[model samples]
Target: MSDPAPDGLMPFQAMEILKRAKAMEATGRTVCHLELGEPGSPPAPKVIEAVTKALPQAQGYTNAKGLAELREGLSAYYSAQHGVSVDPDLILASMGSSAGFILAFHAAFRPGARIAITRPGYPAYVNTLLGLGFGVAEIPLTAANGWRLTGAEIAATHAASPFEGLLFASPANPTGATVDREGLRDIVDTCARLGVRLISDEIYHGLDYRGPSVSALELTRDAVVINSFSKYYCMTGWRIGWMVMPEDLIRRTEILQQNLFISAPTLSQIAATVALGERDYSEEQKAGYAANRGLLHDGLSTLGFALGEPSDGAFYAYAGIAKFSNDSLEFCERMLEEAGVAITPGIDFDRVGGQGYVRLSYAGKRESIELALERMAKALR
Candidate 1:
């Protein structure tokens, strides 16, 4: 039999490793989980309260496009927060950004067409592209650029091997790196010239520390904007999210969304609509992430783990683990086994340069994060 994902990734592979760790925990080993991007905050108080009132009315599925009320809330939220206007008619709801990603990937590009994404980015991006039978094109972004994507890089990159679309995530996974407004505009303009479909994974929107979040809608109208209640709203398990597409792509995306997910859950949509109204709570969570990022920033530097970039957003610090472990996979397993710290090996991210890195997440409670830093300090030493 052939081996699956010669790349060492797969939702199942992640599960297999986590499963063993989970099974081991049955015997009661301490596990400090820093491996996943799963948010750690409680759902907003108002959202939960809405759910309490929605149970009897939300037992059945709603329209395949999701509750119009929820879609309208998303539209208004984007316009008010981002200085951009999106049509509720253009919104297609799905079961979290995972479903949105698949639908967009399928609708935007055909199988065997190439797609470009940054190295050491979200592992799921590469996995999703390949699973759709597409070619993986690499754009090696370095720490020098704030891990930012430049127009020149995209234009020069495609000269060697081009792609049909580009996927980007500011305040990105693992590294927590982001781009400024000018940088984002450069990337979008270049893609427009290259005839590349741009899919901006704005799942981590509103989680930045330094400045405002930049949206693709601000730069170009011809991109797929995928977002979720999963991140900013702290509704990870509810499986609800949405997409913003160009006017022309709306019907096509709706067709795919219909077959792929009969409809978004009725209760979750009701709850998420209320979430859009709770800006104060979302900002509070963003502030907490900023504080955790600072604690981790000072602590990790003290522990001697060389950081990849000056992380300004998201909840992770991707570091160069070269001094301690030549192999990130072996290192992650050892961190779990010896230090009781669970972290993700970098190989799951950038296949080429990932051997020397591991990611640490600060998404846990304050005390748990401190405990992890204490243990990792010793492990690194």
Candidate 2:
């Protein structure tokens, strides 16, 4: 038999190409970066100012869960935004949503359990579950369905042998696809019947162009909601994210957080609390991203790209380029060397259809995105 897949499958694909491109650029080559979904805009000035002013007092940790003030602020935000009352006792701060993944996986899934996740989904979901020895139940989504997993699809795949939980992202990464009201409702209903937990990643919730994204907490009280200030608020490097677990999990998670992360950085928590009060700044950034989203969509179509689905939210467009290359990694390497553009290969997201597709990040400024689009247009032609 062939060699088994390795356990520690680090995110080395993009990094490998990046290092190669860096070496080339040092020799006087120009490179356009479209590989990473990093916001070109900096955090709102109000948020930055808050962080600056609070740095002095935020030095010491108050509690492993989070500062009482910060947690209260987050609880109020949930009530205001979702109209769903969240008690301060229910929230826990963490290093990032990525940290939430680790803690949630370990505490909830139990060892060797299975997790239901969509194919061509965030690759980390698969790797993280696998690293924990949890088998993955892939729910392959199609473009016709907006690349979203449905209740019927789940029943088809695992109604008999259901997983312990279901993990999904709204305005999903890489594809930028959003689930409709019906799809979300159906899946939630099915999971209830099968006793599968639901973990919803709402990192891109407020970054949508079509409208504000949906939250899982609205559908069920038992779901785990993960969110961050990195996207809509332009606070990537801050590394602050929150988790809203069921009341029972909250207690377990609080003790878990104490031993695991101690607490999210005290300074970041202070700044995040302040940022929630600065909605004016965040809304301004959202408008800019909305414009960039439209511009990139039109530009990609003009460049002859077949978008997988309408990007209802987030800043990526997963497109097929079968006419160009069957091996996306090779295509990406060639583009980096010839066009001097840094784009992530879809193989990082999907092992099946990935070879015929690639993901483009439009999180940069208008000017840079225009230039990259022009280069892709020329290179693909």
- The number of the candidate with the highest TM-score is 1
Which digits, one per residue and each the tens of the lDDT, describe model 1 over residues 268-303? 899899998897998888777777778877887777
> Which digits, one per residue and each the tens of the lDDT, describe model 2 over residues 174-264?
8888876677888889888878888988888877777666788778888888888887777788898888888868887888888888889
**CA lDDT of each candidate?**
0.83, 0.80
Runs in model 2 lying further than 4 Å from the true structure: 1-5, 8-12, 19-28
Model 1: residues with Cα > 4 Å off, grouped in runs: 1-3, 6-17
The per-residue C-alpha lDDT of model 2 at residue 225 equals 84
Best by lDDT: 1
Residue 16, candidate 1: C-alpha displacement in angstroms: 4.8
The positional error of residue 261 in candidate 2, measured at the CA in angstroms, is 1.2
User: What residue pairs are clashing in model 2?
Assistant: none
